[model samples]
Target: MPKSVLLLWLEGHLQSWGYDSKFGVRETLPFPTKSGVIGLICCALGEKDPQDDFLKELASSTMEVKAYKNKFNDKTEQGLSLIMRDFQTIGTNYDESDPFKNLMIPKKSDGTKPVGSGAVLTYRYAIQNGKFAVFLEYEKDLAQAVYKALQKPRWDLYLGRKSYIPTEFIAQGIFNSKEEASQKLRQLAEIKKLTEDFSVVEGKNCDDCDVLLLNDVPVSFGRRKSYANRYVSIIKKED
Candidate 1:
């Protein structure tokens, strides 16, 4: 089957996509990750489960992404946004008198049960002037569904986190092949004079880019999440 691509504009002041976290410290990638983009699509289609068949199908497909600054550059693409960190406290200021509020407190995942309430301060990272043009080579049916859903999303859409809502609608159009879709992105970028910051490519070897073993593939989006592995080539422009 011919591949279909999805174009999205992920502009947010605060967007954190952390696949691996230790303790309360979370970090963000400069560009959108595969799992992150997939998560966004599933959210639009109201497919909450990571184990959803659609999720699996998408994980098995080929995908590519590029992050660009909204501001036009001098073609050097030297301008990449810096990641800003936010320190936040979870489970803060709940009235002890309210019994229901106590239940809302975060708990340890010891598999047995949680005792008492735990609140901790954590650090999150995000990029400024974040804009991305994604080219997902996925199944046609799934792509069509996603395009339609974005017009009237089944759930509220956000980039990575709930607070990181998109400033613009994501769906640009569905196209055949990566080049055709990417061509559209280039046109838009040309008009806006956007500069590419970095890009991620899947499956194939990107000799010009650095390779990474990312654990962002979704096997199950359920409560007990499961993940598969995907290779990403990080291509950055020299400053």
Candidate 2:
């Protein structure tokens, strides 16, 4: 069966696509991860259960991302979007007497207070003023359903973080082929005055691209989340 392409335009002031992160530090990749994209879709579909079967099919589907940045000018601060780190302190102060408030306090695995201060410091990284055009290849029926859901999402849609709401519509259009999706992206970029930074494509390594093994594939979601690795090719372009 011929595949259809669902084009998503991800643009926001602050968006974080967490690749490898710990409790102390949450790091973000330059582009959207597969898990992140899938999570957004699940939210749009209003699916609470873990979609393990859907993920299995998604793992084999082709997905491509083209990164874009605002054109450099005297008014703009930088030519490329930069990563911004946000520091937060949790469990600073809470009354133990109140049951609800006590849960907010930091505790050990055994529900005991720490010997030192109860405050926990965490650093979150996000891409500032980042834009991306994502093309996802899917079967015709699945693509149409996803396209409709994104158009009128059951749940609110955010870029990567809940606070980072999308400035534009997430569903751009559904195309019959990747070339058609690329055409739409070019038109949108021209209207937005954005310049291409790079492209990430899935598959074997090529001489002109950089190969990266990313563990962004979702095996299961919910409390105990896991992922598998996939090879991607990154091709950088000049201004």
Candidate 3:
């Protein structure tokens, strides 16, 4: 089948690509996850459904990410801090009688109220000053739909979380091949005075890279979200 590649320039002051951690302590991965990217695409298409069929079509698609940082020098590798922690509190002082406020209160799986003040503390981590170029290979027809949706997204497009607004345009363009998208990525990095820091490529374990298994492939997307595992290779740029 014919394929197309999309070049997405993801640059933002704050972004969180969640991989692990729970409600009390949310952590972020160093790079974007397939699930997160798919979420962005769904948002652009204004698709709030489970979208099992749509996601299945690109189940075997190729995705590559190029991480960038502020250029310091050829000998020195310079980048902002990997993680930024933000402390917050949820479900505080809500009346159980008020239906709207009652929904905010923490509840047990059985729908009963929690055993405490119903307030919980959370530690959210995000990437600071993150910049990445993502190359997503898709079927020609699906790629065109995604391209058009991104140009005028139905909903606001964010890097990861809603608050993490992108500094640069996410839709660079669609190309005929991954190589074409990569060349565009290099040009964008050069124009922005950014240097390559690392990369995440979809694949199994290899001798020259760090292999990671992530349960981030989306299977369903509504209230009861489900995911599958995928292997990716992370290769840091050699100094």
Give TM per candidate: 0.85, 0.90, 0.91
Model number with the top TM-score = 3
Worst 10 residues of 1 by lDDT: 70-79
Q: Which stretches of candidate 1 lie over 4 Å from their true place?
A: 70-78, 97-100, 104-119
Window of ten residues with lowest summed lDDT in model 2:
72-81
Instruction: Give the Å shift of residue 88 in candidate 3.
Output: 0.3
Instruction: Please write out the lDDT profile of model 3 over residues 59-88, one tens digit for every residue.
Output: 557788889888756544455447899999
What stretches of model 2 exceed 4 Å from their correct place? 72-81, 93-95, 98-103, 108-111, 114-117
Tell how far residue 157 is off in model 1, in angstroms. 0.7
Task: Tell me the spans in candidate 3 whose CA falls farther than 4 Å from its real position.
Answer: 73-77, 93-95, 107-118
lDDT of 2 at 94: 84
lDDT of 1 by residue, 50-165 (tens): 45676778777676778776453354534445788888877766775898986556666763324544567888777666777777666788789888988888988888888888
Clash number for candidate 2 = 0
